[model samples]
Target chain A: MAESYRRSRWSNALFVAPYLVVFFALLVFPLFWGMWLSLNKVDLFGGGQFIGLRNYARVLSDPVFHQAVRNTVVFVAVSVPTLVGLGLFLALALNKTTRGSSFLRGLYFSSSILSVTIVTLIWRIVFIPNDGLMALIFNVLGLEPIGFLSTKGWSLFSVGVATVWWCIGLPMMLLLAALQQIPADLYEAAALDNAGKWRVLTRITLPSIKPTIMLVAVIQIVMQFQLFGQALIMTNGGPAGSSRPIVMYIYETAFIRWDVGMGAAASELLFVIILCAAMFQYWISSRKEVA
Target chain B: MADRSAFSPENLTANRTLFWIAAVLAALMLAPVLWILGLSLKNNQDLMHGTDAVFRAPYTLKNYADILVNSQVFGWFLNSLIVATGQTLGVLTLCSLAGYAFARLEFPFRRAIFIIVLFGLAVPEQAVIIARHQMFNWVGLHNTHIALMLPGMSSAFGVFLMTQFFNAIPKEIDEAAMLDNTSQFRIFWKVLLPLTLPAQATLGIFTFLLAWNDYWWPLISATKKEMYTLTIGIASTQTNFAQSEGLGFLSAQAIFASLPVVIVYIFFQRHIVTAVSGGAVK
Candidate 1:
């Protein structure tokens, strides 16, 4: 019996071994390796030498990194709240609808599945000056065409627009599921109190979905914070560096400029920001729960 | 929730308004895709014209034919297929094993190992890309489809999602299997595995979508054109052809490129909605 038990234990370890090897080698090791690289000046040819916190300091002082950070903030600021609000609105709308909502749910969620390349390219075609879809619509309405992707003022907003369109699907689905999970009695109780739709939405629906709202909020912040391929493909952070996000900056630094130390530092900075945002959301969600 | 009363006038009005709003939102979401499809169906000459002229005469499938006949899109499609399918199968298989171990088994340092894996949740792939590239290069896997699939294969999210799922499967089932002198592995494969089909489908669709839509990592890893997935290959080809072949062919290629995943999405969207929300609520 003891021998069989020992053998079973070994067999279980066999099941876990491959994943452990990868978990350590890929996820854990590379993370620490990246950290180590950040503290050293690594060349493609030459071996690294420790340069301490200079890379972090340099990233702090760099204008491009500063711009990237601000751009990321702008993106999150624009997209995150919109995503949460729009997701909740659509979820409620869908949840309330008496007809054909399941089909509409699929329609709303379709764009979220598209590749960044497809999404960006579609938006690019949509936003082209005179010959684009928006331009055609403008022409029909007797309005001047807007240069969404080309101009400085509208560029980030344009990316934000594409992003919101592409992303709202998942959040909407998540929020809708959350909405469906709320017991019908609670809403009925609210209605019996002579509550209006707005009142029920605030007092019952919002409070019921508070956790899901936080989940969607955190997901959006982390995702929007790492805005890369959109800016890379759509605008190339263009017009005036208004849309180049920190992740793109990290990509440029590590790959484009081949500055491994700086890339690592910038990545670490982004990591810290994401971590803070996540922690903040955790605090907010947990505090409400405790109360 | 809308009032569920069958005959109330107010309820009927609310439902009508909801349906109208949904119809408009759906149109807004799908109009761009339909417009691209219209552009693809237009002749080469119509490519230069605005979306207003997209409906005019001289419609042709020549652009589609040219992209199919004259480009390496077929090869890019194959590469994407190989990677997405491979990554999905690989992630699902590996995550099931590890997740079962974490969720069901008792072993030395299980908590510690699980914590380490959980730690990966906070670390984005971008944070480790530089090191991952060097690691892959050291292993001679650079510029390969394997490299493109590798980082994504062993995701902490997969492990976390699967473990949560496995934890939900009642231990009574496993214990009953054990009474028949059945092995743990057998229970995992034959009994519990069959029960977790919905979860597996969810993970499969999620992984497949992430793998299919993945752009940045492939862009970095697959330097050789033949190695490029559909997105990177199309992006590269779009530049070369945009100035020479005009936007019609590019539109055709983009439409062709997105079709398979889009089709899969339409088919499996139910699994996707439930699974994503599974993570959100539970």
Candidate 2:
């Protein structure tokens, strides 16, 4: 009996041992090591004395980091609503079970499957000055071409548009699934009451999928907070750093400038922001279930 | 309401209105894709003069031909394939084993470790990227496929998904296998593992897509030209931002790089959609 028990425990350890090793090495260890690195004056050459929060102070005081934060905030603010709202709109419109609906869902969702590089490449063609699709339209209208990507005013906006186009698919799919789960009987009852379409949507549809809306919103927020590639490819954080995001700032600081300590500090700040968002989601979801 | 008669006048008109709206939106969504496609077929010189030349004739496959002739593009393509497939298989094996342990086996510190894994879900890749890169660099693993594949294998999301899936299976199956004197590994491999195919498909498709599309880690870690994945390799091929000189060629590269993902999406639409929806809400 003792031998059997010991063998079973060893077998159980075998099951989880590999993942735990990777988990510690790749995830857990890196997380705390990153925190420790944030306190030091490390660079690409490695090994430096611990500076004790001076890196954080410098990163916080840097003006470029401020702009990157502002740009990231602008991105999350503008893109999250549009992604969630437009996704909900698309889901509601395509909620009906028909051949056309599924096809349209697929068409919209197809873009999300694409890599950031491909999505940005397609949008760059659309937004490039004087000869892009947008420019072609402007010419047709005899309107002067605006530098969607080059100009500071429109650069982040252009990135937002491309991001929405790329990311709207996931929210749409999630909302559509939530909409499908709303029982048909609830809709039938609302119909029997002679409820107006808007009334039904306002009363029944929105409330049923509230949790999903929150989920999608928080997901987009966390995702948009880490905006690197879109800016990297689309605007390259150009036009006086107007479109640079925090993640890009981290990349530039660490990889480009070789300030690993400051980059780690900036990234830790980003991690805090994401943690807050995740915690907010947890609070909302758990409280929602209770209520 | 679902009860509304299919042929009712009110319903038909509403449906028509919805259809037209959907059609317009679909066109808007597809316009960028189609625009790129048109540009990809046109001559680079013509595109530079005016983007409207896409509508004219004399379209050529020279752009695609150029890409095919570049030996580096093929190398990048192969690298991306190896990394994505390797990562996906590694994630499946590790997650399923750990998930089986978490869901079924009674192990010490299981609850605590699982909580730690769950906490990992909140930790963005950006947060730990520098440290992870430094670790890999220290070990002289940077610019290698192992460097590309190893970090992705430590996916908390995969472990979580697999655990939930394994948990959903009835305990009776394991008990029945135990009655047959089957080893726990045998049960997991021979009996229980087969039942999780649907979950495996969902997780596998997602893992593959993410690994394939991943950029940040690859960009920094795989710095060597020979080590470049498709994304970094293609991006490297660009000589300038908003490159007008090789517009056709750039478009072709974008299309070519995305072709495999698009093909995978076409084959696994159901699984992809399920993973997207279920992965989030759950």
Candidate 3:
């Protein structure tokens, strides 16, 4: 029996071996490499000398990096709250509606299936000037065409709108599922006490879905901070660098300028931001549960 | 349940208003997609003429004809199919083994390994693209579909998701198989594997979508135009055919590119709904 148990233990290790190899090689190695690279002045084709904290200091002093940081903050500021609030609102609205609710839910969630590429492509055409769909709509409504993708002031906002639209589906679906999990008897009980829809929503539904909401918020914030494709494709961080998010900056630094070291530094900065946000969220959510 | 007599007439009116509002919002969400479809069906002249002529213009299959006959889109579609399907199979097979191990087997540093895998979920793919490219180049796998299929084959999300699903399966089944003198590998294949259909489907769909829509890696790795995926193909179509009356053709190509995934979704919408909702349960 002990021999069999020992054999089983060895089998278990063998079963998990492939995953451990790949995980360490692909994910963990690059992560630690990135951390190391951030601290050194590494080149693509040559030997790198260790330069402690210089890359981080350079990133801090760089104007383009500063711009990317500011742009990312604005994006998170605008996009995260909208995504969370709109997701919740839509979830609540769909939850209340009994007619064709499932069908509508499916339709709303279908947008999420279209990869970020497709979403960006569709919106790129939609936001094009004069001959574009948005322009056509504006023409019909006697409103001037808005250069959503071109103007510096509105470029990030336009990308934010598209990003929100692309991502809102996931949270909406999650929140809807959470909302459905709430016991109907609680609502019925509240109704027995003459509670109105708004009152019941405030008293029962909000509190019930709070955990899911917090989860969605953290996930959305992390995702928004890594905003890349839309800026890369739709705006190209153009019209005076207004829409250049951190990931785009990282991409440009690594691939375009061949500054792999600087890009690694930028990515490290992003990792720190994401790690902090995630830890704070974990703390907040756990605290709420304890309370 | 409350009696109908308990609610006021004003409450009924308000409820009706709210219901309509939700319905309207749902319709509005679908408007852009409908308009894109409409625009694809119109000719160059009609599209150039703008929204007034959007519905009034004579619908034509000319754009579709042009794309089908003139472009490399069909080739890109085939390429996407090869990559997506290969990556999906790879991820499913690898993740199932890993997930099963993590779920049922007790090994040294299991929790540490699981935490490492979970951390990959937070690290966006873009963060590692530079290092990935360097590795691919070092291995001389650059510019190959294998390069695309390699990184995605061992997904952290897949392992995490499948682990959750496998954990829910009772251990008694495995014990019963063991008592019957079945090997552990055979049990995984013959006993536990068949029962993980829903989880497998979920992983398949998610993996397929990720592989299908990947643009950056393909863009970086694939230097040749023939090697371009659908996303890069469409972007280049605009630039390459800039002077030609190709907007309509571009739209047609876009629609064609989008069709496979749309058809897949339509057929498997229920599975997708279950899978996405299941993800949140993680």
Task: Please provide TM-scores computed only on chain A for all of the candidate models, following their numbering.
Answer: 0.92, 0.96, 0.94
Q: For model 1 chain A, give the 10-residue run with minimal summed lDDT.
A: A1-10
Q: State which candidate has the highest TM-score.
A: 2
**What's model 2's overall lDDT?**
0.87
Score candidate 2 by TM-score against the native.
0.95
lDDT of 1 by residue, A107-194 (tens): 8888888888888778777777777788888888999988787788798999998999889898888887677677767766666677
Q: How does each model score on TM-score?
A: 0.93, 0.95, 0.93
- Please compute DockQ, using alpha carbons, for every candidate against the native two-chain complex: 0.49, 0.53, 0.40
Badly placed stretches (over 4 Å) of model 3 are A1-8, A44-46, A96-99, A284-291, B1-15, B49-51, B240-245
**Candidate 1 residue-wise lDDT, B1-282, digit = tens:** 553663232231235566677788778878888878878778766565445667776778898888777658888888999999999998999999998888887667778889888778777778788888778867879778789888897688888988999999998888777778787789889999998888899999989888988988898889898888988987776453223235666677778878887898888877777666656633
Residue B178 accuracy (lDDT) in model 1: 77
Q: For residues A88-203, what per-residue lDDT tens digits would candidate 2 score against the true structure?
A: 87887787667888799889999998988888888988998877899888888999999999998799999999999999889988887777667777766776777777777788
Candidate 1 chain B worst ten-residue window by lDDT = B6-15
Order the numbered candidates by lDDT, best leading: 2, 1, 3
Q: Please give the TM-score of chain B in predicted model 1.
A: 0.89
Residue lDDT tens for model 2, B127-199 = 8899999999889999999899999988798899899999999988878778778887898999999999999
Which candidate's lDDT is highest? 2
lDDT of 3 by residue, A153-260 (tens): 889988987887788778888887787677666765676787777777777778887988888898888888989988888888978898999989988888788777
How many collisions between residues are there in candidate 2?
0
